[model samples]
Target: MRPAPAVVAMGVAGCGKSAVGEALAAVLGAAFVEGDRLHPPENVARMARGEPLTDALREGWLDAIGQRIAVSVASGQGVVAACSALKRSYRERLRGFCKDIVFLYLEIDPATAKQRVGSRPGHFMPASLVDSQFATLEAPAADERALTLDATRPVGDIVASAVSLLGEANS
Candidate 1:
């Protein structure tokens, strides 16, 4: 059977979760699920309007992503997903679906995050909400099966590190 690891590239809006997740998926020969694309239209509109999402608003989204992960894992195909899993509870919710799920936390400073978010065009999330994202972030605890990478690093380096970590984790 093929490896069936499930990994989430998690962090705040501008933390390169999408880019790193895509690259990591390519390296792992896995499917890449864009979490933002899975968000409800109402959530997108609210974020576009500079409103932060409440926990209640995010529950369904998290469940949707978890479902995707669960399906992929059950098929014995590895999967990598990008999500702004800024809270421990959010990560835990995902873990509820797949016990072996791993998280790749892209750590970034607020200034860089704000600058990056501001530069992205056509994104629903606004730079104005970057502060809210930071406030919501609860870094993974030491016990969690997670890898922390510097968001400032090049995508290639970050992906390489993740590949190494995943190798060790699966071995």
Candidate 2:
């Protein structure tokens, strides 16, 4: 068996992070955590109003997610967390807390992402914010250990590819 990874499904909103993360967790038999649930009410409100969150507003939320990763690592459990870790700094924060973490970035085009976000209902993140997400996204090209998957692919393919990446990394 391959070693378990502390996995993070990262991308802009509407890239299916939560869905893919959940499926990946089930396949890996690891805990699935939706990073959005850790967001403070203020952050949610800011996004709801189509306002992009400043780094200051995001610090607490990032810390909360990092702490979750730390706890999961300390317990010797693999965790799959879905977060919009849009910047290198944010990813660094997560890595600081979990040493065995592997990031899977869902790469989706702006049009497709906008469509997905627009179609979804009851989500606090407005479609208008997606542009900001893309603008803020600093992809991890330097990090060769990170897996970049096409979010345009079928969900099954995405999950399978992620599993394969995790398998290879842990082997």
TM-scores, all candidates, are 0.97, 0.95
In lDDT terms, how accurate is model 1? 0.94
Question: Candidate 2: deviation at residue 111, Å?
Answer: 0.4
Tens digits of per-residue lDDT, candidate 1, 49-74, equal: 99999999999999999999999999
Stretches > 4 Å off in candidate 1 = 1-3
Instruction: Provide backbone clash counts, one per model.
Output: 0, 0
Whole-model lDDT values for every prediction? 0.94, 0.88
Best by TM-score: 1
